[model samples]
Target: MDAASSLGIDKIGFASAEPFTELKDILLRHREKGFESGFEEPDIEKRVNPELSFESPKSIISIAVAYPSKLPNPPRSEPGAYRGIISRSSWGSDYHDVLRDRLAKLEAFIAERVPDARLMSMVDTGVLVDRAVAERAGIGWSGKNCAVITPEWGSWVYLGDMITNIPFTPDTSIMDQCGDCTICIDACPTGALVGPGQLNSSRCISFITQTKGYIDDEYKRKIGNRIYGCDTCQIVCPKNKGMNWTHQPELQPDPEKVKPLLIPLLTMTNKEFKEQYGRIAASWRGKKPIQRNAIIALGNFRDQSAVPILSELLLADPRPEIRATCAWALGRIGGEEASSALNNAQAKEQEPAVRQDIEKAITAVSQSASR
Candidate 1:
């Protein structure tokens, strides 16, 4: 624990490597309800049993690193200069790298004590459920928002863990503090939080933003100005009120990159996108999803000034998702130029899906103009 504290780990706890029986049922129900985000490992046995990760695993060590919640001197978003926000989780340098480095250091420290100590470490990509491990290891209680909430740091922390052959004293789990609190569920824009501690990932704006295809029209307006993940559930949680952690320097947000101008993002090339957002976690899905979401944000803002660039994208952009989203944005902006662009796109657009999008956008613009 002393070594972990010295290595800048905010919280650490140990747990027995016994199979997670309770989680299996929960996950089974999650699958039955079609709530999975498709990011999880498909094999349920590997997910529930720590033994699958390592031979003779006796204990697991869970660690948490607090990340910053607030950005300093954030750029202002006005009518002409609309900006889209990347969630707090994706604000800093990729947390996977940061957490992996810390875990490697922790492993080295343990190896020094137990020569020939066998260990397997993992971050978010690992098959093991991080929040489940953290909860069992007493790092924090799982919140109704599905976040592991540490009393000291709220839910603003990155989690990682290691499975080890060495037996260790298991810490007691924290008592649930989300009693009678329906704030996160009530605040969900899309009603993705179906119940306490339950999430319908299909409707989650965070998951919706990461999807590659054209977003559903129903969710388009609800996405608001989020370019990456949505933080509405976390922001509304009472436990997270007034909680901000800025201790880890690597976790601090670069205001401009995290909250960037929406207009510039539409025309960004692959190389340009990589150079700017390559190090952040949100860039994992690449530029397509982000660009698509940026177009949606422009529509949500209804910024008439964006109509020109959006019209250009509708005519010239090669990606159907981009072209289609631009049509939607232009329709929302609704002007003579925007309507003309949609009509032109309807005439020339070859892809059936994109053509339908153009037609729908034309109708939307016509309806708005009528009002």
Candidate 2:
């Protein structure tokens, strides 16, 4: 614990490296139901078995580093100047890098204590289910929203773990406190929270935002101003209320970068996107998804000021996804100019899918104008 605190880990707990049999069955069911986000490890056995990751693993060390939830003095988004939001998780420096560094330090500390200890550490990308480890290690109880709810930091902590050959004292699992609470499920705009503790990733706005191609029409409005990820579930969780940790300086968010102006994102070049969002975790999927979501957000805002830019994208953007999304946005922000842009795009669009989008957009704009 002393070593972990020195290494900047907010909390550390140990658990026996037992096979996660319960989790395996749950994951199999999750797959059968088509609820997975497709980012999970395909090999169920490999994910549940710690021995596969480390030779004769006896203990698992789960660490939690709390990140800031509240952005101090965040910039305001007004009528003509709307901004899109990245989730609180992606606001600061990339957490994968931050957690990995802390884990490396912890690994070194353990190595010094036991020179022959074999240790294998992993962050988010690792095959191990990080939350499962954290829960077993008594870092927190798994919440109804599918987040590990630590008492100190609520669900705002980043989780990572290390499997070791040493048999350390295990910690008791924390008691679940989310009984009878269904705020997260009710608050999900897309109905992604299928049930308490169960999520339908396909219907999730966060997952939809990360998708590279054109978003389905049904989910666009629900996505609102979220460009990268969604925080509705967490934000609504009672446990997370009044929880904001800003202890880590590197984890602090830059207000401008996190809550960026939506219209300007449409015009960003590849180089500009990299330079601006490179350090944030939201950049992992690249700029196309963010730009696509920005278009959707502008439409949701009905910001007529963005009509000009959306029109330009509709006419000039080479990517079919971008052009189609622009058409959809312009259709939502319906006006004579937006209607004209959609009509022009529909005439020139060669792609069957894009043409369909443009045609539908023209009809939508017409209907909105009628109302």
Candidate 3:
């Protein structure tokens, strides 16, 4: 504990490197139900068995680093000048890098004591299910929202794990404290939380926002101004109500970057996006998804001022997805500018999908005008 505390890891727990039998059953059922986001590791067996990752693993070390829940003095998302929100998890330096460094340090510390120690570390992108490791290792219990709810950090902690050959004493597991609380389930904007702790990632706003291609109209409507990820479920959780972690300087958020102006995001070049957002976790999908989400947010806001910009993108944007989303946005911000742009693009738009969207947008604009 002293070594972990010095290494900047807030919490650590040890669990026997046993196959996640129950979790495998749940995962198979989740896959059968099409609940996966398609971003998960394809090999379920490898993810459940730590032995597959490293030789003769005796225990898995789960680590958690707490982060702030609140965005202090956040920028206003007013009327025409609306802003898009990035999830709290995406704030500060890329956590993947931070967690990896911490894990490396922990591995070295363990090696000092156990000369023959063999270790393999993983962040969220690792083969192992981070939450399962954390749960078994006693870092925290899996909440109804699918987050590891720590006693000290609530659900506002990042998770990572290390599979090792050391036989460390396992910690006591924390039981679920959610009881009958269904607030997180009810707060999910896109009905992504299909059941307690069971997520339908296909309908999840967070997954939808990160999608590289065109977003479904249903999800686009619910995404609102969330440019990167959704936090509705976490925000409403009783465990996270007043919890705020600020000790780690590297994890502290930049207010402007996390809650950036929607309009400016649409115009950012690849280079500009990289320079501005390269350090953050949300930028992992690159600028396209964020730009696309910003476009959707503009439409959702119905900011008439954005009509000119969105109209330009609708008429001349190189990317079909961008053009299609602009068409969708223009529909909501409909006026002479938006309607004229959509109508003019109808004949010129070559992509069948985009053209169909333009037609739908035109109809939406016409209906709005009629009302």
lDDT of 2 at 339: 91
- How well does candidate 2 match the true structure in TM-score terms? 0.98
Residue range 1-371, candidate 3, lDDT tens digits: 78798999999999999899999999999999999988888999998998888988999999999888799899998988899999999999999988998999998998898898888899998899999999999999998888899988899999999998888898889988999999999989978899999999989888888889898898887888899988888899888878999999999999999999999888899899999999999999999999999999999999988988888888888999999999999998889889899999997999999999999999999999999
Q: TM per model?
A: 0.99, 0.98, 0.98
Tens-place lDDT digits, model 1, residues 156-213:
9999989999999999999999999899999999999999889999999999999998
Model 2 CA deviation exceeding 4 Å by range = none
Rank all candidate structures by their lDDT, best first, as comma-separated numbers: 1, 2, 3
Task: Give each model's clash number.
Answer: 0, 0, 0
Give me the runs in candidate 3 sitting further than 4 Å from their true place.
Answer: none
Error of 1 at 76 (Å): 0.6
> Which residue runs does candidate 1 get wrong by more than 4 Å?
none
Q: Which ten residues in a row have the lowest lDDT in candidate 1?
A: 1-10
Clashing pairs in 2: none
> How far out, in Å, is residue 352 in model 2?
0.9
